[model samples]
Target: MGWFSNAPTANRIQNTNTIAACVALLEANGQVLNEVNTFASNQINRGQQLSAQAFSVQGAGSQLGRELQAAIGSLGALKTNTSQQLDELGQLCHNMELLIQQFDVPRGARTINASGRDIARVAVHDTSLVLANLLVLEQNSRPDIVRSVQTIDRADTVLNQGNANQAGLNLPGMNFRFQ
Candidate 1:
């Protein structure tokens, strides 16, 4: 059921198989992180375009423009956070791969003790499952997030085109962040 649960059911082969399963999960996690980064980059690009439009308009000093600027600032923060997450994920995957390699190699230069290996096995088993679940949730919710950003773009377009009375209707403040 979990990411490291692909190992053998029998006790004799459990240790080696569990290490293999952890390596598999870490590899899959790298792929998943790449996908997440692509989606995040697209969103950041959209925000950049919107920000430029907001700055270029004649109504740049208007309340709408200010709000849009703030929203885009938030988007910038999201981009920064996304970048940090990518770095962390990369480091984590690299460390885990190294650990897995060391665990499998006997008389290797970077060898971990038996107790350390046991602890790592438990940690990777639990945490990898949690990470996989969160990635799935993020993937499932991405479409909705993209559509919502598109809706915001359309609203900005209408405001810029003077199709709506910006003075009469107030745009509600909205904040979006990924947990």
Candidate 2:
């Protein structure tokens, strides 16, 4: 019969329920973020495929050149859209991290007895550390998307250079010419 035993049991139950609810909410937010990441990844793959097709037609004549140009334009547009979506997703994840960090679980009960036996008391777990770790993981994952976008941009540059070469262009100091 310690000070904790004086607190109402109902209040202890309510505090436990609140912690469970917060865990569930955080999990839901994580799932949404995962879905957004999957979408952005798919878009990056599509852009890569389109870029490959465009580059493949670089050495062909006028007809293939026109087709390659069109493909490049389409892929560029897709990359732009995907980049925007990823930025939005990153912002959402940051907001979720902030919310999870601010969650406070109040102390409710400290002692309980079962069947006329005193159970060993354990301290309450602080979940803020776990939530902060999850936020760190989310932040770590963002760089991969950013790198993919940069890679796509580089691929675009390679395609453009190949296209220029096919058109008999040469750098100012280069002895080699496409023609």
lDDT to native, each model: 0.51, 0.41
Give the lowest summed-lDDT range of ten residues in model 1: 167-176
Task: Give the range where candidate 2 is weakest over 10 consecutive residues by summed lDDT.
Answer: 115-124
Winning model by TM-score: 1
Which residue pairs show collisions in model 1?
Answer: none
- Which segments of model 2 are wrong by more than 4 Å? 1-10, 58-130, 153-179
| lDDT, candidate 2, at 120 | 7
Write candidate 1's Cα lDDT for 1-179 as tens digits. Answer: 22223333354256656656665655555565555446545655655555566667645675544555555555445445445655666666677666666554442334554433473676466546546544654555444444445544655565456542221122211112212
* Per-residue lDDT of candidate 2, residues 51-82 (tens digit): 55664655434343344344444434444543
Compute the lDDT of residue 92 as modeled in candidate 1: 66
Deviation in Å, model 1, residue 135 alpha carbon: 6.8
